[model samples]
Target: MAVAAPQTSEGQPPKIKASAASLIDVGSGQIYFQKEGDKRREPASLTKIMTAILAIEKGDLKDVVTVRKRAAAVSMGQDIGLKSGDKLYLEDLLKAALMYSANDSTVAIGEHIAGEHDLFVKMMNDKAKSLGMKNTNFANTNGFHHPNHYTTANDLAILTSYALQNETFAKIVSTEEAVITWLPDEESKSVTENGEEKPLKQRTIHSTNRLLRSDYQGINGVKTGTTPRAGNCLVASAAREGRQLAVVILNSNNRWNDATRLLDYGFKEVRPVVLAEKDELVTELEVREGLEKRVSLVALERLEVYVPRIEVEKIQRKVVLTPAPEAPVKRGDKLGKMKFYLDDKELGAVDLVANQDVDRLSWFKRLFDKS
Candidate 1:
């Protein structure tokens, strides 16, 4: 279930200059603010976010990819200047693609992962559909402007939230700078007299998102994009005191300022409240025919809810557990869920699990007990 956007006492949301924009709570996916968030606009290099997701999930980082002719020929937008037959680790290309918005790196990654550019693009569309990005589409691996290549700020926020869940993806986007090595082309690979291969060349790539370099507190990631048709686009994310927020700005004249102001508004509107801690006991469940008649159920993870400042006192929690189960129950077995609510509306839920093992009682013991 979706949580409604919190109402702010501050009257109006921040004035965002972007043609399309959205600010979302990373944990609960609550929309804090929006400006024509569903309007379709060219994503430009921001499309690399989806490409990075597919590559990380579907391709091996250690795998070596040989740049093809098509990738080498790409000269539009920012690129690492890949040459045909040049080799690089999938990991390096990912860094270049995400941090620097390298167009050629995306093409090579798409070709390497799916063996065809169009097929990889199809995968991108399929993944978008699965993520419930109803207003998004992909026409190319690199976010070069295409007539059909477009997405909304709301959709991009959804994509970024999902991407940040992956440890590798989160790490890559938050990186301010990184160095990637690639084998030199044959023309530059001249061997020494002893026939030893020369060391691979390294290129340093810096993040295109300027907010990462700014004094903005807790600013971490995500990506930046620009093109003649797309104007300027940014997906900026930040985490502070266990609460994470992301803002998407598309076709903006001042994306950095817009993102910062919107994020500030978001942080001011809601505050994080830790309702349950990891391994903290919430309730107990009865176990039938077990050596232990009851088993303690604890929160599998921390449950921190971001509530509006005005509604913090009104928040409530509900624990729903399964009926008595016949043991042998293992530690960490999922038994039920702990749900959060605002008034009558459901906010979110977390799994409740067994805190310890519970073995079934022996038949002889059960029979004697009955007597």
Candidate 2:
């Protein structure tokens, strides 16, 4: 059966079929659009995102993990056919868990990293709390159908944004396909043409995210999930001209089209505006008892933020300068700050620094000037 497309009109949010959805600017954490954003829903395999995060932070990728009986017993959902006593690198397991949404791989990773299945689930919950995911809970390492396993679109967006900050996580999620190797049990090891035993068995895994495989421009990552209760869930991220946006959709009737339309709307609605340019002269600050009475202050770095096109003129700039200070003031010395805001929300801020040196006036010069 063909899925119905989301309804949309000019200058309005697309009426997606997702039960819960959120579109956010990755850099500024600005929410572009949301629908039932705080309503908790089953996350399905999206739980692997948090699993991958803990694995990268707590375990060495090079470490070899022996598949446990519990991991081998995971047969309910997608799996890599791992068996007890099979050995693989942690990195390979991460690839399977994330790219393939392999339920068995997540258990192995959780066991290897936390040394216990329940402990790893606890760690996932603890990490969620730290990330300010207030409406999230994890009942398992892999997002199996558990009564307690639930999260909201808002929380998932926050989690994905934090996870993307890790270079390894980002690289892994953005990958379209990967080959992972594992050491099979002695009985299952294959023999080569030359009569030598092949120590490593290779498996090629492709990302389950259809958008990533499509011709969608800037489509990067992140993950997709499905189960009876969760329906079609996806956390999709894309980058364009250095600006990244993430969309979280849970229990959607048409996840791909819904995500595509929402992302398109977001890109069209918001744009990156350069609030301040690096080294641009902001203003002059008065220096007391210095060779020069005033010192030039320039922005220390470029400040750019994504704001809705309608709110571009609403942005307010506030300059805060340090109280007049006695020289010597060296170039690059911290002098003040320039803050950009939209209404009361702070969009971005940059340090303002002295543009040149200002030495204190000599006592002789001070005395002559006094005369």
- What's the count of clashing pairs in each model shown? 0, 0
lDDT of 1 by residue, 89-202 (tens): 999999999999999999999999999999999999999999999999999998887899999999999999889889999999999999989876667785778999865678
Off by over 4 Å in 1: 1-11, 184-196, 272-304, 310-346, 349-371
Least well predicted 10-residue stretch by lDDT in candidate 1: 1-10
Output the lDDT of residue 61, model 1: 95
Worst 10-residue lDDT window, candidate 2: 1-10
Model 2 lDDT vs. the true structure? 0.89
Q: Assess candidate 1 and give its TM-score to the true structure.
A: 0.73
Tell me each candidate's TM-score: 0.73, 0.79
Each candidate: RMSD: 7.4, 4.2
Displacement of residue 238 (Cα, Å) in model 2 is 2.5
**Model 2 lDDT per residue over 104-220, tens place:** 999999999999999999999999999899999999988888889999999999999899889999999999899989865667778889988786678899999878778787888
Candidate 2 off by > 4 Å: 1-13, 25-31, 36-39, 129-135, 145-148, 165-168, 175-182, 186-189, 199-205, 277-298, 323-333, 353-371
Backbone clashes in model 1, listed as residue pairs: none
